[model samples]
Target: MPAHRYSELHTIPFYECNVNNRISIPMLINILILASEHQNEKLGVDQLYLIDKYGIGWVVTSYSIHITELPRKDSVVKMTTRGTSYNRYFAFREFWLHDQDGNELVKVESIWVLMNEKTRKITAIDDDVITPYQSEKVRRVPRLPRPGRIEPEDQMTSKEYQVRWSDIDFNGHVNNSRYPEWMLDSLPMDFLDTHEPTNIDIRFENEVKYGNRVTSSVVVDSSDNDKIKTVHEIKSSDVLSASATIVWKENKAEGQD
Candidate 1:
């Protein structure tokens, strides 16, 4: 495996959290993306660098983030990442979340695939990029199941967009956090402006790139007045990039009926 790279420390802001004063799932994804970008930048082999040097693209085909303890606003947090291994078509990475005192918070694992820019087809990982990592060998057992369940959602209320330049990450793909921006944008302004998300579960299935037209769909359940359930999905044509479930809790202020 490659020598350990630096783990960047990031502070949580109130806006990063849902109405519950805890980090939002989407924001957490952003943290991971940020850590990965920071590590690559430090290594001098970051995403854009990779693309400009090589005529290829990388997409986060899968991600599994386990939220152990949610960090609150102003909480000092640390994100650690390591390139684990690669075999055949997959490159693996592991991430750990730590609190200020060095207590473990969350653990994450992900895999990404390289693609040809012209054809937009997934290609194998090029040695030029993978060789430096010298990643450890990982067993191949048909990796874990990814998050993909296709069901029609309510008519998307909000169509706010994320420009190509703004959302692109070091990998030349839309950063994971951008998914949440599309998801939340479809939500009622009143909902996110005042409430917070209690929990969010999402799976990264594919990568949507610059100039890719993405549509956000949401389905909401109103079983309880105080709590609401929402599902957010981002798609291009028939292929899905990611799907998310967000649970919202109203602010603690009086009269939120």
Candidate 2:
């Protein structure tokens, strides 16, 4: 088969949106994961095959996605992805989201590290995997900004969510990815649907236990418009649970969370 690169599409549904009837953070994350699965098919490996064949997995270390518009219920959105390059431990990939009419909606670039299953350390992507994709080396690298932080004394907002039995993973705690839900959940309805998040750096600080009430809050720095930073913090009293920053595009009216 000839080696080629192509982008696939995914549609947004009503359940994917939040109270604002806009696409939620969790749904956005879910869409990207699905897009990657299809993109891998073009490279002779879907998500499942890649994980199983190499005993290797791709984890998102950092990502920045700018959303120009929200995909409404039953609206079809097209997503295109490409492996831009690989520099040792960092593999660069770009994804573009668009309307069926071909208007670009969101642009995302993500950095990932390949990991060994049992040892859980960074590893190299072999030539076999590398050669299949016609990728060029990204010469000029753009530095991503750091995620935000919240002080211990900072006043915070809270949300009480029951750790349903289904939310518990094999590790016996709420899935780390679920924190984005709690984080974004703290934002306003208009903010959830609009605004493009130009940057977002999330670090998992700790695990959220089942049946525990996790309060969430955000810290915003009003200094720069080129980049808007909002910190997502999940905590109990003074103890921290997890934190994330959603960097918005110049337009703050769209994504408040």
Candidate 3:
């Protein structure tokens, strides 16, 4: 199997950046996924090809992202993605964002699974679908670390959101990018304004369809003023849809807290 890696250069636009002129994590996530979409198109196994031919599509199950520095507005950065390995049920992939000088800015490790289009159930990866990426197949599946659990007894700040049509991707489920946005939005504005995430671990357990209402709940642990940890969960009709843990560092740069 040949190794297939893809990279693309992007200029950060103003809208993609936050109040501090740095690119937001959710937007960066979308860009990383766009890079993967381009790679699939290049390999001729894009969503359309797979769905039309095999009645299947890829869905993200989990992501572990590390942020060294967030790219600022108008900065040109290179985004790269590749399939590390896969098995019958899962595919492991990696993504990296590098600055103009080649310094790593962000790193993302992810797990993906194939889902049947009509049945919306997890499906096995077929040789025809997995072969084009040249990803190695293993009999033993990798054990990725799961997100820290959020106990029901923990006090939480929560908000309700109605899924909009735009939130649905081509797969007919909520876009993976929206999970972090919902999670982050549940935090207090002051915390979000004064802090930036350094590490993020999120797991998607169930799919949320358009028009469904979801409650985003968060628990903040501020015991460490410098390094804060926040636990987040998204639930619809009492079913847990997604959960995430974000580690943040205080932004020393002069700004509103």
Q: Using lDDT as the measure, which candidate wins?
A: 3
For model 1, residues 10-118, the per-residue Cα lDDT tens digits are 9999889776677876788778878977877776677778768876755666666565576777888988987778776887877888999998887777787777776
Give the lDDT of residue 66 in candidate 3.
94
Residue 86 displacement (Å), model 2: 1.1
Residue 227 lDDT (model 2) = 66
For lDDT, candidate 2 versus 3, the one ahead is 3
**Error in Å for residue 93 of model 3:** 0.4
Write down the lDDT that model 1 would get: 0.72
2 or 3, greater by TM-score: 3
TM-score of 1: 0.69
* Better candidate number, 1 or 2, judged by lDDT: 1
lDDT of each: 0.72, 0.68, 0.90
Displacement of residue 2 (Cα, Å) in model 2 is 14
Q: What does candidate 2's lDDT look like per residue over 101-195, in tens digits?
A: 89987777777767665566779766666566665545543444446778777665656666677777544667645778777777665665555
Please, what are the lDDT tens digits per residue for candidate 3 over residues 1-257? 55699999999999998888889888999999999999999999999999899999998899999999989889999999998799889999999999999999999999999998899899999989888888988875566668776797888989999999999986678988888999999998888888899999999998999989999999988888768899999999999999999999888873432
For model 1, the run of ten residues with the poorest summed lDDT: 141-150
Error of 2 at 36 (Å): 0.9
* Candidate 2 segments whose C-alpha is farther than 4 A from its true place: 1-4, 137-142, 158-177, 188-215, 222-229, 234-242, 247-257
Query: Roughly what TM-score does model 3 have, to 2 decimal places?
Result: 0.95
User: Candidate 3 — which residues are off by over 4 angstroms?
Assistant: 224-226, 254-257
